[model samples]
Target: MKQLRLSGSGGQGVITAAIIFAEAAMNEGKQVVQSQSYGPEARGGASKAEIVISDEKIYHPKIVSPDIVLSLTQKAADKYYKGLDQNNGLLVVDEDLVPNIPDFPNVVKVPVTRIAAEKVGKMLFTNIVALGVLVKLSQLISLESAKKAVEKRVPPHTIEQNMKALQLGYDAV
Candidate 1:
């Protein structure tokens, strides 16, 4: 199974991103489990989501040590980076939000929020954009399935815009 732990500020849609990932994996006929936790604050507090995808049956429902960890906030980066395995773990962070993050050898810095605001003109869709980049990197599921999953989840009126956000994100990398 492939484990992914994604975390960010409360309003950044970290949980939603994991749900999207799990949905795309499910569309590809894989077994997927998603779980999330968040602080009390609605905007700035920490939020985290864990996703596990496997071809075989999944017995454990939680992420022990994620293979992929995406951290959009500095606190999230600090909290999870130390726990990641050096041999198999990969970390992705938002360069703008986490300026002074520690030097992790396997880390990838992506200006996800800035990219989303500049390319899609919406901070609200930043998480979806980040999810696009992550899904692209993992190749856990096809991009088509991911796009379809986004379209299915978003509201009808906003679906096109969100898909455009995903495309912009996919093309950014």
Candidate 2:
């Protein structure tokens, strides 16, 4: 089983990213469980979304030691980075948003928000770009499946820009 935790501020689309990731895993015939938590504030509050994927049945929905953790903020990195698998795990962080990354062997530092703002011309596309990075780094889900999920979840008018953001993110690393 693979456990993934995506953490960031609210309105960064962490929950939506988790849903899309779960959908992509499901598309690959994997059993996926996704859950989320956030503060009362709608935006700029701490938010976390967890996903568990396996070929076998998933009995527990919660994740203890995640195989992959994406931290888009310094607070999230400080809170969740220790929960990663000690021996083998991947830590992905937004370099621009997270200034202090823990000392981890398998850490991937990407300027996701910066890339979204500069390449896609909107910071709102950060999550989609992060999704693309996750897809590329983890290889747990196919790009096609992720794209399909994005198409299904995002607003129709923003599909083109989101796709561009996704592609730019994929190309970044």
Candidate 3:
């Protein structure tokens, strides 16, 4: 099984991104389980979503060791990055938001939020871009499957921009 944990602020849409990723994995005939947690503060508080995917049945939903850990905020990054198995796990962080990134063998630092604001024209698209980055980095699901999930989850009018954001993230890696 491949376990992934996505961490960010509450309003960054990490939960939605995790759902989209789980849907993509399901589309590929994988067993998937997703769960999330958020602090009391509604918008800027710490948030995290964990997803487990496998071809076999998922016996346990909780994540013991994540293959990928994505952190979009300094608080989340600081909290989660230290516990990862450095030899095996890949760490991803938003370079703009996380300044003091940890030293890891496998790390991808990208300005996900800035890409959404500048390229996609709204910070709301950060999660979609991050989803694309996760798909690209992990290869857990096909990019085509991820695109289909994006189409399914996002609204009709915003599909174009969302797709653009996904591609930007994919190419960013």
lDDT of 3 at 102: 81
- Error at 17, model 1, angstroms: 0.9
Give all TM-scores, in the order shown.
0.95, 0.97, 0.97
> Cα RMSD to native, each candidate?
1.2, 0.9, 0.9
List runs of model 1 lying over 4 Å from the truth.
none
Candidate with top lDDT is 3
- What lDDT would candidate 3 get against the real structure? 0.93
Candidate 3, 1-173: lDDT as tens digits = 89999999899999999999999999999999999999899888889999999889898787988889999998888888776897888899999999988877878899999999999999999999999899999998999999999999999999999999999999999
Q: Write the per-residue lDDT of candidate 1 for residues 1-173, one digit (tens) a residue.
A: 89999998889998998898899999999999999988888778889999999999888899987888999999999999887888778898999999987668888888889987887788888888888888777878878998999988888988877887787767766
Clashes of 1: 0
What lDDT does the true structure give each of the candidates?
Answer: 0.87, 0.92, 0.93
Candidate 2 regions with alpha-carbon error over 4 angstroms:
none
- Could you arrange the candidates by lDDT from highest to lowest? 3, 2, 1
**Tens digit per residue, CA lDDT, model 2, 1-173:** 88999999999999998999999899989999999999999788999999999999999889978989999999999899898777798999999888988988889999999999998999999999999999898889989999999999999999999999888878878
